[model samples]
Target chain A: MSQIDLQKILNQIEEIQALFVFVQRVIPYLEEIIRFVQETTPLMEEVSQSILESSKKMPTAVAELDKVSSTTESAASDMLDGIERMLDTINNSISLIDQINEFEKERLMKEKALVLKLAETLDGIEETQAANVKQALDDFYEEYLAKNCLQKLRQNIFCLQNDAYEIMNSLQIQDITTQQIMAANDLIESVQSKLVALTNRLSFLFSASFNVDSSQVKIPASMSFNTMHSIQDINNDAPGKTVETHDSEVSTNEHPNVDKIIKPAENSTCPVIVTKEKQRTNDVNIEQDHFLQE
Target chain B: MQKTILIVDDSATIRKLVRLVIESMGHHTIEASDGLEALSILTHTRLDMLITNLNMPNLDGFQLIQQVRKKYHKQNLPILILSSEEEPEIVERGFNAGANVYLYKPLIPWQLRQEMNKIFTQAKLGRD
Candidate 1:
């Protein structure tokens, strides 16, 4: 009985000694793992803090994205409206060209009639001049006997020549005015061509700007603080402020929701500012009362 | 002693009108279509006065006046500007270009005579 127990006790002791050796072998690996965990804890905490900060900013980012989307939609809508207006203006210009053509035709007709009338008047003057020459020749024989009559005839001839000269001088207005009108027409045509080129370029730029798909537009998650502030500044700026016009109806129609979007924030801020001003006044009054009491 | 005047203008009608008015005063007039043509005529002929209209092709009245001034003094050969343009700046430019007088067009014959008489009186005084 004693030998059996001793043998069993010795085997258990050997097993215990093997277990201690195994534990000793694993201790450095355990220490390395613990050190690794300790080193990674700060990184995990930083990750958790970063995730918490992102979560805190998510609403603001989403709101900013919504605002950007709205702004883009509004800008695209305005651009499309501008394009429509431009097309209408082009149509009006086309109609104006027809009007100009009609006006030119009428001007030409009037000018032609005036020319015909002028030619008739000139022919009549010529006939009258020829008759006067014939009369003068016939009267010369009768009048040449008298020196006084000859003098009167010479004076009459001079008067007739002066009248003809004056008539010739009065006709220069047409040519000068015609040249001025032609120059003005050339200037208008040049301006029109330049305007058309400008309109085409504007149309191209607007089309490119508006063609960006809103659904595909993505705001970067890791946007810098300065960039975020710039985005906020852009959001705070008055929408449709770039458009200026004499027509109030057009402006109002262009940005129907602008007042709706801005009025609530304005109203809320106005009350807050007024309340703060009142509180400041109350604080000043309280300080004055305390000083008077002292 | 009839004075010979050189008339430069783009318009034939205006030239004729000016010629008639000037010739009525016993002055002989030689016509040219533009400043360049007037320069050609002036190189060959001795002229008492030069009457030019502004805004002509090839050479303008200012260039003509400057060129004429280079050859003749204002007292020797008086340059008169006859133009339809009534702008003050244009009148000032004409005077600056060495014109003795700037007269707006649709000119009265008496006014032309008066101005010419004044220029002639001045020229005569200068000669004396």
Candidate 2:
């Protein structure tokens, strides 16, 4: 062996020592992580089981809340509907009162016109004839005209007063509707706010209880002999053959093709490795046995 | 057919280690004490791979790789850089210089073998 080979052997031995130390350090850490997982799994499972039960409770609570919200919504909607109907009724009554007031004003105008015509008739008579005419007119008023005129005008005033009362009542209805609408708005807002709060609480609870299993922390081994052994197997079957075959025949090219297959042969201690005779005899034995069997 | 590999480093120990690894693999290794010596050998002889150390007295591994990459543009030579330095910047520099594998020492034989095997296989596939 060359001095270089001796030096490499020394280096390999050092590397192996370092690798052993590294592995020694790492194995405990891995065991600790594994042990921790093993110890913590039951605790985690218990926590998860409790969370699952709590999650079950959440759905029932959510369902109750949903029912309450739906009922409240329906009740509020019905109240609004009733209020809307009341408003429509008030609006219709107000319109009717306005029509009655318009009819009363027309009646009043007609009565005033009749009163003016009577005054004009009285002006057409002379003053000297007034004593005789006044007596006759007084008799006519007492007997026929006075009763009719006073009764008709009183009836018109009564109708007008009744229309004004109706208008006042309609105004009161409108005020009550406005108040009811305001109250309904407040109720709806409060209910919606409560529902939103419940939803937010549910979201928080859901997130908190969602169990996350800490997966096994995998750390690479310091030096895996198994991995090395597999690599050696591959090298033995393919690359090793290439190296042995190529190295036997030297190339004349500026860049020899053999450079690609070169590696430090690790199995040098096996004295039987380089010999062709041992392999040939083994092959011959197999062949001779096969022939004998045939 | 002895696969010829060039080892470039100022450290006698590292060169010796690499030479041993190469020989143990039943391949031939040529030594260069520095980047300049590596460059001279590279010019005269064809190599399968170059295993080098980054820090050297004259013409460090980086300069050597640069020179080789420029000269052997057609050779498709695989280079392995062995160094004790663990700085990210230094590793990037080695990669930038066209090193196929960067090994931090103390070198593991198995790891070294694996890397060498990969380079050889890849180089062979490229030829095929």
Candidate 3:
């Protein structure tokens, strides 16, 4: 062949070899397309079955969810009811606390009122007692020991005795003031009886004139020794010693003769009795005597 | 500047009640459960006056007063003792122990207010 012809033949052989290589690459792509179709068929069937099963289960699941939601809603409503009751209880408790506060306020007010009342009562008692004490002191000075003293004393003493006996008869000893007054009255009565008896005997023996214009005659100042001694004997019959003093001796401070009247005055509230030891013995004797009688 | 008071008591209820009354008068309050606690707080905080109960757990009213006087070395620290025991000797002892005023418990709020006002005014005058 010529050189140009030989070159053309070589170029054609090169083109044919390139065509064979392209054909060999196209065979593998065709086989890959066939393999892809084979692998995708089962996978597509599995996906379709799974979707069908999921779709079928959705309604049942929705029904169960609906039931659960309704139950939860009912539970929430019950909780709301319980909360409402709790609120009511709290309200009642608050009201009760208010009532208690009101009661305490009222009680405090009453206590304040009571304290004021007690103060007023004490003031009244003090005022009344002050007036009574003043009146008693005035009466004691003006009525009993005035210048008409001895005769008045004799009359008042008798009256005091009667009044004392009456008070003792009327009152229980538990009454403190009444018991004290009654005891004083008893002492006045006993002393007054003895004095009255003595004065009458002195009047009889004196046999002297009096300056009184009235029929009730006053005894003469000059009474004899025998008559006064006899009067003393009569008085001494009671539980005390006899005093045989002249009127001169009675006036002297050395004699302290006024104690005849003053001794009873000092012991006016207390009865004259034996010593405490003698009294105890007397009490036991009385008890034994009573038992023997029984 | 507001005046501050220290109230020392074992009872929370009493402390709260006192706080309400004192704070209502535009004053500040610091609370301590007992005298020892009050002594502890006083070390760090400034207080114008003190109101304490007589009977307390850690330290009693007399002991607290003595301790405070000793620590401060000053006579101007006002103490008001409040208690139910009203014996004259107890009141005398409180005054002897450097208490400014002694008062009975379940106190009238108005009376307490007056006393606190008086003591605080005195304290102010002293500081001035």
Candidate 4:
């Protein structure tokens, strides 16, 4: 235990104190990181819970949409059937009325001829009375049957049948609505896949720290998109595309294959931002260009 | 004059509605559910008019019209578009594809008949 030994002991003591200070400085940062983890854990779990909840609900909603399409189509078919039956019945009625009018009209004309021939043998007031009776018979065919049955009633029925057809035209909305639903289904499916991918990435990143399981929630892959076009990405690709600028309204154009197209309208409600003006390039002729879409 | 017409659309309701109009006018109507179905019918049946919708499954209206235009019967058979596709470029493309007239959906029943009659009259006049 000389002075050199004392110096060695002091150096060792200083090194220990420096190491303690370094650890002391690092402790707050470590505590902050631990606190951040503690705060974010619930938030992450909440996000996972929210995603799980949405994934569960969307499929039920999609099933309801399918029911709506099927039910509407069935109803439309029934309605068309009723309309067709009505038209057939009306046409048959018109034919029957025409046949009856012709027969009754000919019979009335021959009876009037007989009455007039018999009146030639009648004297004074009876002849005029027979003439009046003949006039009444004439009125029955011309005024009563022709005016009421042939002219107005048939015409009205024809107009009514046209009105029924107009009702059928309104059924076009079923197809259009189906298209809109298909478009929505297409979007929802896309969102589902993206969310699933995001969750997978997130789970992989936090596997060591988080209790989140990658398999906890899953969104089913979409079975099919709309049948409006083929599988060409140029032809049938769904959005992330938006409308090119036009007047004040958002563009809802369904054709997505233009060369200069940046995006298509996401929906009626979502306002589109056009970074570049879209040009309807006439170059991508459907005959010449073809490609497969994912 | 009555003429035989082909109504091509994926929607059965649409085809039926158009058929009702044609039949009501004393004309005969044949239907095809898609473009390919239409092509199959066109191979054997002689049509005076072709009423079509633009978007469809297998071969679309544009493709259908193009194929029809290439045939000899296209000279007599006029093509009419009954579609909800209102985009200008798309409509222009339809006309360029050889559609004689383009009609939008939610169509007035009488108006559609009037348009069809007008087309028939024009085609008859053209032949004369």
Top of the candidates by DockQ: 4
Candidate 4 error regions (>4 Å): A1-34, A123-163, A208-294, B70-76
lDDT, candidate 3, A95-188, per-residue tens: 6656665675566556555655555567675766545544555565455335433344445545654443333222211122322344455555
Q: All candidates' lDDT scores?
A: 0.58, 0.56, 0.54, 0.67
Candidate 3 — which pairs collide? none
Question: Which portions of model 2 miss their true places by more than 4 Å?
Answer: A1-294
Q: What TM value does model 3 have?
A: 0.31
Q: Name the 10 consecutive residues with the lowest summed lDDT in model 4 chain B.
A: B69-78
* Model 1 backbone overlap count: 0
Worst window of 10 by summed lDDT in candidate 3 chain A? A255-264
lDDT over C-alpha atoms for residue A234 of model 2? 20
**Model 2: per-residue lDDT, tens digit, A162-258?**
5533332233333233334445555655655555566556556545633332332222121122223222222233221311113233222221111
Cα shift from native, residue B55, model 3 (Å): 0.5
Decreasing lDDT order of the candidates: 4, 1, 2, 3
> Per-residue alpha-carbon lDDT of model 2 for B8-66, expressed as tens digits?
87545446555655665779889998998988888789888899988776799888888
> Candidate 1 or 3, higher TM-score?
1
TM-score of chain A of each: 0.37, 0.37, 0.32, 0.53
State the local distance difference test value for candidate 3: 0.54
Model 2 gets an lDDT of 0.56
Judged by DockQ cut-offs, is candidate 4 incorrect, acceptable, medium or high? acceptable
